[model samples]
Target chain A: MPAVHAEGLFKVFGRRPADAVRRLQDGASVADVRESGATPAVIDAGFSVEPGEIFVVMGLSGSGKSTLLRMLNGLLETTAGTVRVGDAELTALDAPALRRLRQERMSMVFQHFALFPHRSVLDNAAYALEVRGVDRATRRAKAREALALVGLDQWADQKPGQLSGGMKQRVGLARALAADTDLLLMDEAFSALDPLIRREMQDQLLELQASLGKTIVFITHDLNEAMRLGDRIAIMRDGRIVQIGTPDQILETPADDYVRQFLADVDRGRVFTAGHVMVPAPALVAPTAAPAQVLQTMRDTRAGSVLVGDGDGRVVGVATEDVVRTAVAAGASSLAGLPLLPAVDVRATTPLNDLLAAAAQDEVPVTVVDDDGRLAGVVPRGAVLAALGGVPRPAAQPPVALAEAEAVPPADETALITSGGIRG
Target chain B: MAESSDDSGLLPRIPVGEWVDTAFDWVTENFEPVLDAISTASGAGVDGLTDALLLPPAILLAALLALLGGVLRSVRFGIASLVGLLLLISMEMWEPAMQTLALILVATVIAVAIGIPVGIAAAKSSRVSAVVRPVLDFMQTMPALVYLIPAVTFFGIGVVSGVVMTIIFALPPGVRLTELGIRQVDGELVEAGHAFGSPPGKILRGVQLPLALPTIMAGVNQVIMLALSMAVIAGFVGAGGLGGLVVTSLSRLDLGLGVEAGLAVVILAIYLDRLTSAFGQQRRGFPSFLSRGGTVTTTAAASSRSVDAPVTGATDQNARPEPAR
Candidate 1:
């Protein structure tokens, strides 16, 4: 049996009694929601969740992604159509049976981290177990174990408010873990965090999923988030599943215009890697090569930048045509003194947001490096944007609005780094 | 010796002697004056109290809140609420009713002003909440009568003491709910706020407050009802108006008068509750402004304890969210 199955679900809400009923009764596709009293929120939507797959329901607000997620646990009953969790038909189950199913078989981590504020982190995490009538000591021990799994072992006595955004989410995950459920539902769990924090959480989730192997249904509207986290994503539109497929398959092929448009604005720069960038590392570099030689080498190699190595086979300098003229004209004394952006190689472990921030704003392409400072390859700014869902490279040097997003410039950075300031 | 100290620490030891001593001191300081104020107000006619003299203001307030409620929900609900107020007046219950309304309004205002900030504090600081939690629990469970003694002692009867006790009784919902609202606020919005480099205060004021307004307003609504409930109790001390009237009628066993006054109180309660709820529902600043649907199933899921029960229990489908049917 499928883990979660919704067969032709229908939920309508509106005013104007007769008309609203007519829409639902007549099966008018795409009922004019604005009209009459009853607005059908979800209509004839159907889907099935297979075991052990990280199934993602992706949709913007009002598409009923959250409603769909809630229906799985019987937090909400479908207006029309049958819902089944595992082999048990949810529509047929009584409230107590549903609660038992939710408590024993599945756990939900709300988007808001709905950990009880009155309880300590341990108690909050262990609440599901406590509700299940587990002994306090055993429940607490389980909570501690779960908290450790989420890397929040030390914050046991603290409340949800005391923890950071990512930490609170960890507690939410810990609560689900303590429930000892086979299935976990995450409703935009990390969407409420800072971008950097969000990235870390995604990586953490991926790592956790790999370890726990819990059958998870993750809901998110952010296409990039969906692409990164989902084993298979179900793109939802107007309370219906448009398509379901893996990231690579979805990226190369979208189901419809809605999916395509969403994919268009995605930031792919961080997702792409040096494997896509490397041509072949050059064995030699001429010390006295003219600008023409460097230009020829770059073109022949199809490299965004060329590394200038010494006799010891260590990279001493690098040259990119975009800014090489300044370096060349400045002479070795001044040039070598100023470290070039292309020469500094970043590791694979580097997050995209950080990599973008560290990379120079100019036409410099960032180089990728392995553990030993050996050049792996390079990732251009364009590639980061591509990997991130091909979001338009904003006109601003920084991908974000610096004044608003990077506003207040962390007291330390504000003191030292002074560059091209956005003139108001 | 250490074991004895530890053993002593584990005892449920409240001093009846000390309680009696304080209680005696409190009664002498308050009981007489509260009695005096009541006799004085009754002799001076009900108009001498806050309501009759403040009739225009009371009606004006009702009108304004009712109008706002109308815009939020429907004109009919607003009009019906106004009529509810009119019934209180037609029963010749105007002065006492108004006094009761005034005390409730004042108490609720103070409760909101103080409660919301403390609630926000609780939401932000678990340590602070841990400290405040037991205090709030005590405030909640200590009984309205128990709180009245302190309220009378501190504020010394009449409107002041009445308002004080009302605040004590009603303050919890405001704070607890503010904390709840803040807690329940969508994480996405908070993150979006943070992503904008918004400080904690800004995120709270701009994002969390607006989104949580529905729940916070629900708290405010609870606070209002609690304040009203405290009104009759407030009468036992020095609070003037309908509560005083009830005490008078109940004392004489004036069946006609007692039932009439009681009915007036219910009318006032209905008017206020409806008006406040409608206003809460109609909040335009609320992100969705979708009056909580009249759905049986709220965000709350039923526990495994019951299944045959209609998922949406018939305790009138959570009045907080129910749209006008």
Candidate 2:
């Protein structure tokens, strides 16, 4: 089962919630519902999180992303629908049971770092555990461990008022960490910090996530942060989810004009992965294939190079046209003996910025490999340039030949890309 | 002329005064044991504190006051307290001053004990707050002398009645401020407590109360000041203290004795007022003292400057000293 599963969740804010929900289900607009004295904050919102993935809910303020996040943890009750954390239905739990769930199964970090000003850093960090009725010594020890994890053990005795904003936020993170729950709900947790501090905190959270792998439901208005931290992001608008996908998928193919507009300012070079821009190789040749056949296949596919893969699709090497032609003249029976050009291989997950850096040094298309070292596709220099320039490749031919695509002048490429034409 | 005409054409006046008179009589008759029990408890508390204050050697009490002043605030406040106590001693009104202090202390303790829980309840529920607000307003606005009539009617003439009346006069600020303070605690902090799964009671104790403390202490300070101001009025009902001396001296038109006793009262008021206000300031984490050019402006010094003007003028003029008669 997923760590968190929310289905058909609707939250209506006002009296006569049932009436409002009926109107919403009957396809009434949010404004229409409001006219009748009810406001729908979240409508039919649903999503599930895997056990250890960072699932981010992204939107502008008042978009119901926060409301959705709160519903997942039962902080805000759902007017209609069910939320299950692990196998337990949150909406079905009684107050005591729900509190126990919050105490033992999930914890939240707030935007303002809601720490008690009167409490010592150590005590504030240990608060959740204290609420859970953990014994004092054990709670303190655990809190100390969490504080050390966040690099704040030295400030344990100091009051929260004595800490800087970054340090106070760390205490908030430590409090959630100390609870040792399986799920973490972070509501715009880093938005209050200065930009530099915010970046540092994001980096710290990423590092912690790497080591801990806790299921996190992160809410933010920042698309950059959502892209950096989310394994999958759900983009919300006006109480409805417009799109949910990996950062690269969202950047490459936004679900609608709203999502596209929402992503207009995103730095695609950092967000789009090699997998997003990589085209399938023009051709794949076997090691035992005749050189004549290899050359024929490359010409038929209008390709500069072909990847040599084993029967199971593992990439052994690249075979260029020049090598194939030389092999054919040399009377080589198999293409394996040809002096193939060296090529850079990168994982499909490599960002376009890194792909551009790798592609800059290589003449041939860079090979993209899956997690298991199987050939996935190739990212040509043209594809990188086109993607970075925001130029849309032809729809009929998904993978453009590098030589043909490179014919565009660098100045036109710069103008076309800088004009943000990729949306087309 | 017809419209303006007569009392005979108007509605009959409700006999509210007679109803109140009968109600008080009925309560006094039936709840005599309960009333007596309250009087005994209040009397014991007042007498015990009065004896304790008066039994200590004059120098020892002054030293202790100075020490308390220094520890809670600053050495300047300590020295000021020392001078004030010495002035009381020099006026030969030490015992009467102690009795007045005792009455204020007893009334304040009782007021706080009853006030805070009521305040918390008022803060927690809108209905309770709505009910409590009008009651508090009535308690505060009713003439301080009105409390004496009912207090004496129930407990008869004694220190108990005086203390009871002082408590009624002083209780409103304690309750009102406590409610305001608790209500004013940041909503986010309370939400954080709830989000962490702390029970409501724990949230109140651990989160709400601690944050509200400085404001509540300010309320306690107000209560003490109001009680001190009522001490003189309490003496009208035969409660013996500096107020009694002022009353006796005023009847005889003995200006010298009355002036001395009134000066003693002013000194005591300033001392207690300075101490309690400094405590409130200290709780808020402001640096309570500053040393400058051989004059230390302690927290109390700042407050004393603000309060001294009207009080000193009024006391200097009225200067009614009660006698031991």
Per-prediction DockQ comes to 0.02, 0.59
For the second chain, the TM-scores of the candidates in order are: 0.72, 0.87
Best candidate, TM-score:
2
lDDT of 2 by residue, A250-295 (tens): 8778899999887778877877667666665433466888988767
Return the top candidate by DockQ: 2
Q: Per-residue alpha-carbon lDDT of model 2 for B31-98, expressed as tens digits?
A: 99999999999999999999999787988998898888776677777888898888888888889999
Give the poorly placed runs of model 1, Cα more than 4 Å off. A15-27, A268-424, B1-325
lDDT of 1 by residue, A16-35 (tens): 53455356557665645445
Chain B alone, model 2: TM-score?
0.87
Task: Count residue pairs with overlapping backbones in model 1.
Answer: 25
Please tell me how candidate 1 rates in CAPRI terms: incorrect
The CA lDDT at A178 in model 1 is 83
